[model samples]
Target: MSIGETPARPRKKKKHTGRNIILSVVALIVIAGLVAGGYLWNLGRTFDSNSSKITDAFPAEETRPEVKEESKDAINILLLGTDTREVRSDETEEDEFATLPGGGRSDTMMLVHIPSDRKNVFVTSIMRDTWLDIPGVGTAKINRAFASGGVPKAVETLEGLFGIRINHVASIDFEGFKGMTDAVGGVTINNPIAFRPVHNKSYYFPEGEQKLNGEEALAFVRERKAFTGAGGSDYRRVKNQQLFVKAILGQILSKETLTSPAKIQGIVQEMAPYVAVDESLDATKVAGIASSMLNIRSSDMEFFTLPNNGPGRSADGQSIVIPDMDTIEKFGEALQRDTVDQFVASTDLSK
Candidate 1:
């Protein structure tokens, strides 16, 4: 070896470390893909097998609001929560739309809006006692629309009021709250106010963040009687419900839950039995919708109640919540224009 001749370079032994690392990563990715694919397939099957379907849930196209070009890709889903203890066996389908389960008296109503960008989800709660004109039934509480004409009438009334088209409807019995809460191994929520659920007085929820099991969650979301005065209005219940929603979404999306195939499967199976969606929202459609929103996180969800005057009484002396149409109309317009983010930013959501 001559010192000045760049010491006869020893031929470098071939290194396979980089290639081996690449191969190992590719193999792991393939295995993970297989596992995830199998898990999702099973989940879809379970969801389809247990869920119920509603036919022709929407009203006539002429009667509902027209979808604007900017809002064409946005999705609006109406979620109804009902306490259906009695089943009317003699009910008949009216105007092609089948009567919703629990005879169509919705206790909880929310309009879920997902914009075209899919960056955020907005949920606006509508009080059951809100006074609005029901189609074909004249003036009445909004909830009466559901009982009078089921899904079609309910959809018509809301579409007319907001001037925004509703794309889908999903009805869930109150019993679902328990099963879903338990399936997710119970949701942990921050409790702003403390109270006991009306049905179960023994379960007291204290203020601050706490974990609630199935029974406790049911009570927490359903305890309207515990609140009194201005704060006790349906606003409290809606707030609690919204909080539960955010908490459950966080839990379901957590790495611990998403990584566990059994937990994800259990959630779908348990929730499906109590849910009924419009015919178009089948398991495959649902999976597609979920896939599109893969980037969404719990923090991206925004919840607010439709603006309304505190409380009022109808002409007949029945108590009601008077909607602040002036403000809500602006919200609706934003929906049509697909500028809800700006509308939400400029407007006050304290109500």
Candidate 2:
């Protein structure tokens, strides 16, 4: 069977809405993994049994990078947030069927790299529109990897780009993002600069510390049209995503959240139905992975974007982000050698 043929479930075509853009559904999985411990037995079992499982979501082993003995204990997880909703009535056919795969483009792609020592967790966000080569397809936007061949193509494209062996993969539905925020009783983030978005003009976000409910939080991370100028939209959007993730982490680690078993349980159970992970990451494996990172705290996580040249037009006139390949090449080498700290320090990761 073709790699993309392994179905998680039948796709139900939902109408396109402003909330279609998912920001941190996969990040919730990472949070779940970090929180897993003696308490994780139930979380793991609940998550494993309730969530969908993607069969054969990875490419052939021969084509993947081998983990160096020195970095044997390190893990790289590809976290993707996808939207399968149909295009709006006003959209063109090209917009609706722009890619081969029916699962739709991955709205968010983050590589969560956990070093062997587990002292720090690094998250590198890959711009969805970064022009890159997709396996079995010519060069195109990196997001197209998911749209063209589902999880396997997305995995293959990333491995080929970073030369890193992905230990696991996870995709989450956008609805999970809202459920998780509500389950945690909401998250607060300090807004650096804010404005009302075009989609929802009535929702005014002032510049200051802001407390956001589930629906408002979704709008906060997904607003790009409010940022004017070329390249400004995605640049600010990515930063918002990182900031929101950090806030969620803080809330999760807070006394209120940690002390309340009901809250944590609510988060896992509420989010489980919207998540899908590789077949290998079953209950036992998820719990094991989580237990190993039990020492991880919100302060230890570092989030940054993969360096990219400023936004520009493609040869065909489509707007795209030019990746900094030279730096990316070195980044790949660091992943293999487990010297990402050194690489991150020396590299100019400015977008």
Best by TM-score, which number? 1
RMSD in angstroms between candidate 2 and the native structure over all alpha carbons = 17.3
**What's the distance in Å from true for residue 184, model 2?**
1.2
Mind giving the per-residue lDDT tens digits that candidate 2 earns over 1-351?
A: 477686444353232222343435566766765665556777777887789877888988887877688788999998876555555575344344323223543567789999998888899998878999898899898867766776788889989988778989887766677788999999998999968977778688899898888888777776777898888887888888888888987888778987898998998898898788888878788766766877788888889998788798989998889988888899988998898988988877766
lDDT of 2: 0.79
Which stretches of model 2 miss by more than 4 angstroms?
Answer: 1-39, 84-86, 89-104
Off by over 4 Å in 1: 1-31, 85-99, 102-104
How good is model 2 by TM-score?
A: 0.83
Candidate 1 has a TM-score of: 0.87
Evaluated at residue 79, the lDDT of candidate 2 is 83
Model number with the top lDDT? 1
